[model samples]
Target: MTASPEIQEIAIVTGASTGIGAATARELARQGFHVLAGVRRDVDAEAIRATGIEPLILDITNPEHIQALATRVQGDSQGRAVRALVNNAAIQANVPIEAFALDQWRAMFEVNLFGQVAVTQTLLPALIASRGRIINISSVGGKVAMAAYGPYAATKFAFEAVSDSLRRELSPHGVHVIVIEPGAVRTAMLGRAIATAGELVSAMTPEQRQRYGALVHAVNEQAISSTKSGVPAQAAATVIAKAIAARKPRTRYTVGREAALLTMVRFLPDRVLDRVLAAALRPHYPKLPSVYDA
Candidate 1:
């Protein structure tokens, strides 16, 4: 049973439990698209539904949840194709690369990179059928890897690659892949990241602390202060809506002015960029003792 074009205008948003995902879900709903809000908690699902959007219990990293979501979306679409998929779920680990454990790296990828890929792959068929678009929620970190943010930025770097490859591969098939790279937009994630940094510091061995304690404290405090002046989550959501509706959306979009400025860093040579980064982080980096020191 072929569904009508109007019936196929459905949008699925991952990580609708909070932040930009929640804002996107609300925005899409307002834009007249039938939105499937993917959330992990029952409470979140209920709250999202109250806004007249359909909320599905989803944990993108959980294979069972992913499979279940695929099935539910298929059945619920009633032969209609799914229009858009917003891969907006991500997690952050903010420790220095040297202090990072393999498990911590894996944990970050599990939710940030792998989960996004899993959700995109699982629902690709519906997207293909509808000639839809894939909106990936990335970060300014995708273009610039900061000192203590290396691991988290690495995930976004990989994501930029994935989106580029997917966009090239899907263009001929009438599917559009767009990456949204946002700078610090206000969200609960920041506070959680700050708290997580403290946990990471507490979990460090005495030797690890000696090497990274100062840098970690400096980075966490800076992150907290920066969030105070970030753009609202809805601002990013508005850009997502524009991307979805544009006749020819760009391959990549930097959501905020700061993000656009950050993306320009790619034009600089690695050596030049390295010097700039070193200067920015030097104040926070621990000073080593010289032979003349007491």
Candidate 2:
């Protein structure tokens, strides 16, 4: 590897505030890398500093920030090349297909898919120079669709394809590209998803609300329980950091039990999978009055 920054390999981890992103940033720092922590909020700078990592104010959706990052990594007179880029920032907004909002869908993609791409492309030259790796943090949702998670799943699926193409294209240049697909972990996003679902269901017509009330409740309960019981974000981050540090990294790293199972489910017959999903996600609707009963 061609080294530029004297303080070990300089690693840039985006969304380094809390959860997996934060854990990964800390792990990288512990591994003796000069870590550049990227977060949208200035308040998070202290959190990164606490981990002994340098903080950069970066909102993936901001074009100016992307440009600045690219310029900085390209180096000035001294010439410093970033050795690794961990695209760990993402957002999950659940929007059931039937009632999906275009604005929310676009917002999710802006952060989860488009934002990652903007940063990656901006820093590609430096990555190529260092023969570094790019780790795109995806999710199991990307591989399989579930009810009420259409928007999030769609973006993740897109991320998977994007990562795959980058891996193929960059392999010859000694740049490794890998993806991390973590299962549900206890995070703020999970709670937000539940709240969003409740809001959506509440706004529906009384009849429609009645139709989906039970189903929505069931989903919310499941989500809350899973958040409580899910793999800790730190565990997932460990797997991700390993992926970045390994000399021969795998193309994909899946964390959590459900993440692994979903990969297998990908091979099941389409009809079988569809039926399974229906059972899991079909909303409960009360039976209409029959003419005989009336």
Candidate 3:
């Protein structure tokens, strides 16, 4: 049964506290959808509360929050059909695979990958009932994993795979599952990642530090440079909105030129790609004393 013309459709965006998530929530609301913006704190909830946008306290990792979100959607007072679910909550840290502890790796996956899965699973029933869209926010890292981005990239890669599988499975059910691959967007996420990397570097043993210290520094510098030149979160949100609104949306959409180019070249031979990535990092590495200089 189709929703009445007067009933506003609902769109849910996780991680609506900041960056792409927040921008998408505002954009969706402006487009006339009643957006359920998921934030983790009361402060964020209050900040995002506005006309057509209702903020809910949601930590995607918490089962209680997920269940509450499901209940809220199912029991909407207006009986609005859910239109879209944007899974955007994620965290990142730049630490080498060897230096990152196993528990830390698990923690990253719990939020970045598993949390997203849990949310999607909970909402699939409503999404399928309404023939809605599921938009997964991936990254350029989903296609190309640079040095010191192992754990984060792994989660994105896994998400990319899950998106593909879910898309195929749901296509027959009139549900669209889309993936958005965004390059470095000018967001606070990069600053937080750099700080986390700094903490991880300090915790490394002497041998581990010696092995990965320069590499971590280079990665951080490169990230800062890329973020400075990156597109605004609004640009990504625009793309996401387009995908959600399209009658026949593509399975994947890239947010920026950098994301498009990188995802395109991800098929290059491994050795060649390695050289290219290494060259990109070389300029950011700290200068080292040579024997001649000594």
Point to the candidate with the largest lDDT: 3
lDDT per residue for candidate 3 within 1-294, as digits (tens), equals 222348789999999999999999998888888999999999999999998899999998899999999999999998888999999999999999998999999998999999999999999999999999999999999999989999999999999999999999999999999999999799988988998988888888878877888888889889899889999999999999999988889999998788999997889999999999999999988788321111
Query: Clashes in model 3: which pairs?
Result: none
Model 3, runs deviating above 4 Å: 1-5, 288-294
For model 1, the superposed segments whose C-alpha errors exceed 4 Å read 1-8, 281-294
User: Best TM-score goes to which candidate?
Assistant: 3
137-247: candidate 1 lDDT, tens digit per residue: 999989898778999999999999999999999999999999999987999888788778778878777777777777776676566666677789999999998998888
Clashes of each: 0, 0, 0
lDDT of 3: 0.91
Candidates in order: C-alpha RMSD to true structure: 4.3, 4.7, 3.2
User: Predictions ranked by TM-score, top down?
Assistant: 3, 1, 2
Query: Could you tell me the C-alpha RMSD of candidate 3 in Å?
Result: 3.2
Worst 10 residues of 3 by lDDT: 285-294
Cα lDDT for residue 264, model 2? 83
TM-score of each: 0.91, 0.88, 0.95
lDDT per residue as tens, model 2, 1-294: 223235466789998888888888888788767778898788888867854488889899999998877766666444545778999888765545666567878888899999999999988988888888999999998899776677888999999999999999999999999999988687766877767776777666665555556555656665676668789888987897788778799999899987898888888998898887667554432245321111
lDDT of each: 0.84, 0.79, 0.91
- Runs of candidate 2 with Cα error greater than 4 angstroms are 1-7, 76-80, 205-208, 278-294
Report the lDDT of model 1 for residue 196.
83
